[model samples]
Target: MRITNNMMTTASVRNINKNMERLSKAQEQVSTQSKIQQPSDDPVVASRAIRYRSYVARVEQYQKNVDNVTSWQEVTDSALSDLSDVMQQLKELVVQGSSDTLSDSDLAAIKEDVTQLQQTAIDTLNTSYGGRYVFGGYATDEEPYSMDADNNVLFKGQLISDFNDNGDEQAIKANIGYGTSVTVNVEGQDVTGMGSGNLFDTFAKVLDGLDSGDVSELSDTLDAIESNTDTILAAQADLGARMNYVSMVGKRLDNDYTTYKELMSNNEDVDMAEASAESATASTVYEASLSVGVKVMSKSLLDYLA
Candidate 1:
């Protein structure tokens, strides 16, 4: 069988084309720093990379939720701390006001301090952070308290506010009690029991008695103020526990985020050493193919005569 010039030329052209294709593919792989440039290169690895990316995205979203939760916890803690301090000051005022030996003038002087303490409580309740009322829950734009002309307190917002971390309520545990679900803002009256004649209720009465010169009410005022202090302390304790819970959840979220990042790296990140080896192998194969093609093409028409 004779190998004609036209056939030799065609064969050489085919080998050169094949080598060029290999060279292009190797260069692409080197530039991309990936063994799998396209899905066709390694369909399984590509699919795994997709899943890993999705996992990383979800982890990032959870991280954002953790941030919000942490912020909420901080606000809760601040409010509770302020409330505790207010209770202590009110207790002192009640003690000073209870002295029967003091003149009406002395009691009247102490009443001013009580009024200031009450005003401070109001201010703390209406506290805002980042332009939003911290205790307002979802009513971020609204103040949680409003004072009447008669010095009475009214809750201006909801009792319970909703805070969700990661779109999953289970991820968050802001609410601690098992009572009626309050609105966005927990009313001072609701927590301290104003109508039920709790400690806070007695404190209000004591403040009124100071102006009325009702010396007999001073003893009861002291009792109520002390009791109310205890109640506020308990609520503050609950807030502290909730803060701890948020901290724990945040830690778990951070660990999960780290794990997800590592998984994503394993799935999609290139192995530099392995990629370089593969590129070198591809180069050698491509060069060998070119050499073989050149030798075959050099035979020419004389080789056919022999």
Candidate 2:
């Protein structure tokens, strides 16, 4: 090999460029706080980072669903609690109205109170959360119960049996974890007995019985009111169970999110201490390479020949 000045200059320049590239890479890692800015930097790490990020995203969505489920269940539980209180008040009114010595004016006042309590029960059954009826089943847009011109309680929403034919009473479910779901709604019929002559009808009957001083009908309504109170308690229990399940799932999701985030950081995040050391070393090497290249390239062919 002649070992010409031209060849020496070319080789030195190439070496300097290689050193600059290494320095640039180190600087990028330190500046961005990332090991692999692009997939080409480290394909395996990049792929794993992608997967970990996707897992974290999914966990986040599950957390949101769990939150929504919790909110719905809380609303349902509150409504049931209110209904229980209303039923208790109605029971007291029924007992007073059943007395034999009550006058026509006294019976009228009792009827008025019963009517108000019935409306309260309807309002409780038609409770809404986030602008959607909690007991409307799938018909979240409409009220679950309403009173007719004849003071009869009607089921405005779909019943469980009606779900087969475009019914809105289907249970509301949420995905709280991988391949796991929980129902967050209590159907109106289940809570209010809307399907089998309803709690509201019982209230109306009590009101009419009180108005006419019909002690027999009022006594029967008292029994029916007790049954309705039991139904509300049952629905509250179901909501409580669902809420517990949601809470458990939420805790697991939080832990999973933490794990996924740690994995993602390991796959793509740069170690600041290591990156800083490497960047400093690369900078020194690049500077040395540039000095060497300048010295080599400044020498002419004549000087080499001499």
Candidate 3:
């Protein structure tokens, strides 16, 4: 085949274009600090980077869930602690009211204290966190317990069995990991005697017993108050366990997030030093290609004719 000037010029232009492309890619990597600016740059690396990024995002979300769970559990624990203190105070009042030496006026004063204690317990039961009732089961938007005009405690939340379609009275849960979740609440019935009966019924009865000077009934209320105190204690224990689980999961998620970030860096981020070196080399080669193309194009018969 005969060599032609047109063919030579075309070939030189193609080589210059190829060299410029390499140089451009190297410059992009150095400037952006990324191995691939587009998926087409390196499909395999880009795919792996995508997966690693997804994992990192998921770990971040799980950490957020763990944080939310911790907040809810902390609020629940604090409220339960308050309820426990109230129960203990009520128990003390019950014991004092049972004494036969107390006068009518003294009994009336004790009843007043009992009423205050009952109201305190009610407030504790209606505790809210982040604008949602912590003890309302899945019906978190509503108060779990309230007092009517007659001072009777009313249940305003879902039943334990009605919390979910599975009929399990599980509290609100947070997804902390793969196939893992933590319950972050204690239902009203579990702690405040909302479903079984009024936790403060014995408090009211003790008030009545004091009004009539009935020592026997006041003495009996001591046992009922003890039972309610035990219930609150049990709920606190459960909340503590859930809190522990959430803390452990949070730690694991932290470690996972660190690992995911490292993996993503390895997959997608460019080594600055190496990319700089490559960019320098590509620049030198591209300039040499331009020089060679210019030298070839200048050696033309038309130049001699001019």
Candidate 4:
């Protein structure tokens, strides 16, 4: 094995280039504040980061679903509350008209009041949320209830008298979690006599009773009025349950968001303290290698002869 100047110089240059490369990588890690600048630097960490980021993205999407569901529920709750209040007012007016102590004019005024309340109920059932009807069920773009020129109540374009054919309809829902969804609406038919007493029909009875001076007829409406109120209460209860479920899912999503983010950080994010230390060590080694290479190259065979 002959010791040649070419071999010594070649080995020293290679060592110096290797140290420079190490320094460049360490400095880049520090500057970028990332564990790896490219996936090729660390495939395992890159794969894990991808999975964690995807988890974060999914959590965000489900969170948006939860938010939209919450908005829908809030709108539904408001409409139902107003509807309940209308029922209460109708009951009070019915009780007032139940007494025969009133004059003809008083009965007439009561009839007017009943008519206005009936219209109000009709309007309430047609309520919309975010440009979509709250009670519209599957047909959110259209009103649940409407009134024709004859003051005949209509539900989904069918006469109220005939709308009961649909019976009970399922509420619309939004998925807020994996395998979990929240119902955000109460069917409008439930208030208009589908599986419940017809509120408009009850209003008609009240008006008729006042028109005929029939105190007994108005008294008979207490049962119908009570039934309508119970229906509203039940709808409110169901909405509340859905809201609770959404809240629980939202909390879980929040937790998942935090967890996925932490995992991503652990997998991909750089540690400033450690990265800085590594950069400094690599820099020092590179400088030392350059010094040694200069010394080794300075004393080549030609330089010794000079």
Task: Count clashing pairs, candidate 3.
Answer: 0
Tens digits of per-residue lDDT for model 1, 2-76: 967678779878877887787787677678766577888888889988887887776676556556656755765
Clashes of each: 9, 1, 0, 0
Query: Each model's C-alpha lDDT?
Result: 0.65, 0.85, 0.84, 0.85
TM-score of 2: 0.90
Query: Which regions of candidate 3 fall more than 4 Å away from where they truly are?
Result: 1-8, 98-103, 157-170, 194-198, 300-306
Order of the predicted models by TM-score, top scorer first: 2, 4, 3, 1
Model 1 bad stretches (over 4 Å): 1-30, 100-106, 129-132, 157-190, 198-203, 213-216, 287-306
TM-score of 4: 0.89
lDDT of 1: 0.65
lDDT of 4 by residue, 266-302 (tens): 8898999999999999999999999989988888567
Q: How close is candidate 1 to the true structure, as a TM-score?
A: 0.75
Instruction: For candidate 2, give the lDDT of residue 295.
Output: 91
| lDDT tens digits, residue span 1-306, model 3 | 998877888889999999999999999998889999889989999999989989999999999888888988898899999998998998899889889999999999998998998888878888998999898788888876777677666666334222233445746777889999877788887776643334756666777898899999889888888888898899899889889988998999999999989999998889999999999999999999899899878778887688
Residue 40, model 1: lDDT of: 88
